[model samples]
Target: MPSTLHETLIEMFRERPALAAEVLTGPFGVSVPTFDQALASSSDLSAVMSTEYRADAVITFLSQGEPVHAVIVEVQLGPIEKKRRSWPAYVANLHSRLGCPVQLLIVCPGASIARQCAEPIVVSEPGLSLTALVLGPDAVPVVTDSVTARRNPELTILSALAHARTKRHRAPVLEAFLAGLDIFDQEHAELYADVVLAALPKAARAHLEVLMTTTPHRYQSDFARRYFAQGEARGEARAVLAVLEARGIDISEEARERIADCADIDQLDVWIRRAATVTKADELFA
Candidate 1:
C-alpha cells in the first residue's frame, strides 16, 4: 500500500504542475524554457501489447499549445531496483508521445536513497545512459522565514518533509509550515499537517505540539483538533509515568502497560495526581 506521505507528495505536484518546473529550475538549476502553462500529462506510458507502466506523475510544459518539455516525477522513499529499471522506459515513452525532450525527476526524502536514484541507468544502446535529477534532503532548502514560506507554501511543505530531522531547523521550519497552512483549504490543510507531523522526529513533533497549544491561531483547521487531542493524551501518559518514577514507586509491567495504553484525558489526569502520592504504582488505578 502506498503510504500517506507518498500520496501527499504526489498530490502536491498534481495540484500544481508548475511545482515540478520550480523544483527543476530552483534547486537543480536546470534551464527549463518559459511555458505559457503546465498541465498534468498522462502518466500511463504503456505501449500496445506491453504491460502497464504507470509513473507517479507526468507534467508537460506547453508554449502556445505546443509541448516544449515534459517531466516525469517519481517519489521514491526507498531504493527499488525495479523502479530504477522502468525509469528509462518512462522517459522514452513520454518523449516519444509528446515529441519533446523529457527529464526524470526523482524525489527522495532520504539522502541515501537519493544517492542511489542519482546513479545513471545504462540502456542497450551503446553509450546511452539516463541520469535522474534527484531532489533529496540536501537539495531541499530549509525555508525558515515565514515570509518566504507564505510566498512559496509548496516548497515549505517539501522542506518540512526533507529537513524534519534537523534540530536547528525544526522550529522555524514548523512555524513557516503552519503559517502556510492557511493558504490551503480545510481538506488539504489537514492532509498537509498530517504529512508534516508524521515526517518530523519525536522531539520536533513534541515541539510542534507545544506550538499548537501556545499559538492556536496558527493551527485552526480540523486536523489541529485531532492532533491536539492525541498529543495531550500522550503528554498526560508521559507525565503519569514520570511522576511514578520520580516518587520511587516500583511500577509493575501491567501497571505501566495500563498507563501507556490510556488515551482518555480525564482518566490520565486522575492517574497523574495519584502517581505523585500513591504508595504503590498499581494504586493509581484504584
Candidate 2:
C-alpha cells in the first residue's frame, strides 16, 4: 500500500505535469524543450513482458502535436536497492515507448536519500551509465513571495515541504501556501495542506495551526472553507494533546491513538475541556 506521503507527492506531480520540466530546468539546469502542454502518460512501462514495471508518474511534454520530451517522476522516501535496478529499466522503457528523449527525476525529501539516488547506475554496455536527476531538500527553493507561490502553487507546496524546518522561511512560505490554495480545487487544496503540514517540524506546525485559527477571515472561498475545515480538525486534535501535556499527564500510546482518531468536533470539544482538569490522560475519554 502506498503511504499518504507517497500518494500526495505523485498526485501533485500529476496535477501539475509541467512541474517536472520546471524543476529540471530551474534547479538542475537541465535543458527541456518548450512545450505547449504537458499530459499524463501511462506509467506502466511493461511491453508484453511477464514482469510489470510501473513508475510513480510519467509526464510527456507536447509541442503542437509532437512529443518533445517525457519525464519519469519517482518519489523515493528511502534508498531501495530494487529501485536502483529497475530505474534504468524505467528510463529505457519510457524512451522506447514515447519515441522521444526521456529523463528520470527522483524526488527525495531527505538529503542523504537524494545523494543516494544521484549515484550513477552503470549498465552492462561499456561506458554507458544512467545518472538520475534528483530534487531533494537542497534542490527545492524556498518560495516565500506570494506572487511566486500564486504563479506556481504546485512548486510552492514542494518548496514548503522542503523548507518547512527553516524558521526564517516558514512564515512567507506558509503565507504563500495559504494564498495559493484558492487556485486549486477543494480536494487538491486539502491534500496539499496535508502534505505541507505533515512535512513541517513541531514549531512550524504549531505556527501554522495558530495562523489557521487566528485568521479564519482570510479563507472565505468555498475551497478555502474545505481546506480550513481540515486545518480546524488538526487544531482540535492538538488541543486535546496540549491540555494533557500542560497538566503533566503521561499520554499512553492508546490514549494518543484515541485522541488522533477522534474527528468529531463536538466530541473533541468535550474531551478538550476534560483534558484540562483530568488527573489521568486516559480519563479524558471517560
Candidate 3:
C-alpha cells in the first residue's frame, strides 16, 4: 500500500488532470499536443504476461474524441530499484493501450531523490532507453500572488508543499495557499490544508495555524460565503435523501447520483422542500 503522502500527491493530479499538462508545459517547458480535454484513464497497465502491472495514475489527452497524448504520473519519495524496470513497462503498456505517444512524469519531494529518479532507464533492447521527466522541489515555483494561485489552485498547493519551509517564502506561500483553498469544497479544503501543514516545518506550521484561526477577513470574503453555501447544499442533499428513505421512497441509482452530484444551493433547497411531501422519490425532480 502506498503511504499517505504518496496518495495525497496523486489525488491532486487525479482531481485535476489538466494540472499534469500544465506542469509539463508550464515550468518543465515540455511541448504537449493540443487537446480539447484531459481525462483520467485506467491506471492498470497489466499485460497478458504472467505479472500484473499498474501505474499510479494515467492522464489521456483527447481532441474531439481522439487520443492525442498520454502521461503516466508516478510519485517517488525514495529510491526503489524495481521502479527503474517497471517504469519502462508502464510506458510501453499504456502506449500500446492508448495507441498514442506516452510520457512518464515523476514527482519527487527531495532534490536528491529527483536526481535518482531522473537517471535514464536502459532497456535490454538495443538503442531503447527511457528518460523520465522529473518534477522536484526545485522545479515547483513558489507562488505568492493570489491571482496566480487562484488561476491554478492545485499548482499553488503543490508550490506550498515544496517551498513552505523557506523562512522568506513561507508567509506568502501559506497566504496564497489559503486563498487558493477557497475554491475547493469543505472536505478538500480541510484535507489539503492538513497536507500542507504536515509538509511544513514545526515553526511554519505554528505560524499557519495562527493565520488559519486569526484571519477574520478570510472567513468574511465571498469565497467563504460560497464555501459555506456548498456545505449547506451537501447537508440539504443528505436531508432530502434521508426524508425520502424514512418515507419508504425507493430512490433509483440515477436519482441518488443526481442528489449527490448536485452543487446548486437553490436546486437543493427545492429538492429538500419537495422531498417532504412527495409520494415518489422522482417527484423531487418534478
How do all models score by TM-score? 0.76, 0.75, 0.74
Q: What is candidate 2's lDDT per residue for 157-255, written digit by digit as tens? A: 778777867887887777777767768877778777777778788998877666655645553334555566666677898999998888889999988
Candidate 3 at 38: error in angstroms? Answer: 1.3
**Cα lDDT, all candidates:** 0.86, 0.83, 0.85
Q: Candidate 1 residues 64-121, lDDT tens each?
A: 9999999999999965799988999898888889899999999889889999998899
Count clashing residue pairs in model 3: 0
Stretches off by above 4 angstroms in model 1 are: 216-286
> In model 3, which runs have C-alpha deviations exceeding 4 angstroms?
216-286
lDDT winner between candidates 2 and 3: 3
- Give per-residue CA lDDT, model 3, range 1-286, as digits (tens): 7877788889989998988999999879999999999998899998886468888899999999999999999999887598898999999988888899999999887778888888899896789999999888888988998888889898898888788888889888888887888878777876777777787789899877666655364523334455556666788889889989998999999999999889888899889889889999888888
Top model number, lDDT: 1
lDDT at position 178, candidate 3: 79
RMSD of each: 7.9, 7.4, 8.1
Question: How does residue 102 of candidate 2 score in lDDT?
Answer: 93
